[model samples]
Target: MVFKRLRQALGVGGPSVETVLANPECRPGDHLEGHVQMVGGDHPVELTSVALGLVTRVAVESGDSAYGTMQEFGRRQVTDAFRLDPGQRYDVPFRFEVPWETPLTDLFGQRLSGMTVELRTELEVTRAVDQGDLAPVAVHPLPVQERLLEALLRLGFRLAGADVERGHLYGVHQTLPFYQEIEFFPASRYAGTINQLAVIFMTDPQQTRVLLELDKRTPGRFTGGDGFGRFTVDHATATHTDWPAQLDTWLRHQAG
Candidate 1:
């Protein structure tokens, strides 16, 4: 019994954990329901804690260079300390709230390129921590966000790329450490004035805030600078708002 206890303390053959999400797709400010299933190993063990975290890849700037790293933006504890016996099975249900500033991984039922969101489960043993398999999840855009994207598309802008950049946006209220930028190539009508445009969304339960950055094009060796425009709309008014016309006005004002 002592040898078995020693092994258990060392986490030589502790319990295994697997997380399953009931709904693999969700929008921002939503809840993801799941369960952590555990199966005992050769010996009984004491588990300190079990938690879930939302993780994604972010770009980090170092000196004059930048690199990619995995970052966890949100975490929630699933269970407290517990004891598991040999050959026993346990299931712990969890409902985790997805952050309001969570980045979108899917658009129009299709996964966006270079975007991924995962739920990570961590099991704490006496002397070791075992990480469960990552559960991939799709975070769709909110109704307001969807409307804005549709307006951009209607204005002849094509999605060039999207990425989550480390650091906060200037003059924006951000809960997460990173912000997502959806890049677009300017339409033919605006190509002469701007080279590209990028959109960022910061949302809450009440309203959705949008930031538009226009990268103006210049001649000679000097490149043009960025012009920013910001606006907010209530969730209820998103579907009824004239997004295309409003966006055109904003663009013209910025260009002028």
Candidate 2:
């Protein structure tokens, strides 16, 4: 009897948790509304807290090697400490605000390759943490962001893949530890000059900043090298600008 009581006290049959998002689709600077549905186990348990976090996969460079791991960039508390009675059903609703720097996982109604974003649920019982299953969340691009992408496409750049890196970009102000890079394949028109490209977008409520990096296929002493440029403008200005023309001009200058 003592062994059985010990197992139960150790959270062996504490409680089961399942999180349900009202709508799993969101954009940066948007809100994720959901509820944490929980059921009491074989006996009553003391709950410490419940929370939600925005999580993504990031690539980390360790000297000569690189690896991928999951990281949470944002978190919000759902409920405080409480006692859960056996067979009781308790549902905690939440509205987690997605940060403006949150990485993108989807564009044009399609999921990007090598990209993933999910909501991580954590429940603590008497100081012992119990992590619930991850709930998938699809983060799409904002209007200005979409326009930037469309401009790249119109300039004949093919969408490749995207990944989050675990470091900072120089000269760019960022609140998050990691940033995302959207890669692209060069067009035939720029055949031997440009091999590949990567674009990074940083935006806040009022303005958007863009960084363009190119993998040049230069012939001389520089075989395959990288060149980059940056620009910042308000949302209205970004929407009005001719992206294809601007990007084309910039590419020509870098390729020269």
Clashes of each: 0, 0
- Residue-by-residue lDDT tens digits, candidate 2, 1-256: 0000011233567777767777888889999887777888889888888888888999999999999999987887789899889989898988899999889999887899999998888878765876666778889998889988988888888899999999888888998999999999998777578888999988898887889888888743344577788998787676778878888898888877
Pairs of colliding residues, candidate 1: none
Q: What TM-score, to 2 decimals, does candidate 2 have? A: 0.91
lDDT of 1: 0.83
Judged by whole-model lDDT over C-alpha atoms, candidate 2 comes out at 0.83
Number of clashes in model 2? 0
| Cα RMSD to the true fold for all candidates | 6.0, 6.0
**For model 1, what is the error of residue 115's alpha carbon versus the real structure, in angstroms, after optimal superposition?**
0.6
TM-score of each prediction: 0.91, 0.91
* After superposition, candidate 1 runs with Cα above 4 Å error: 1-12, 219-224
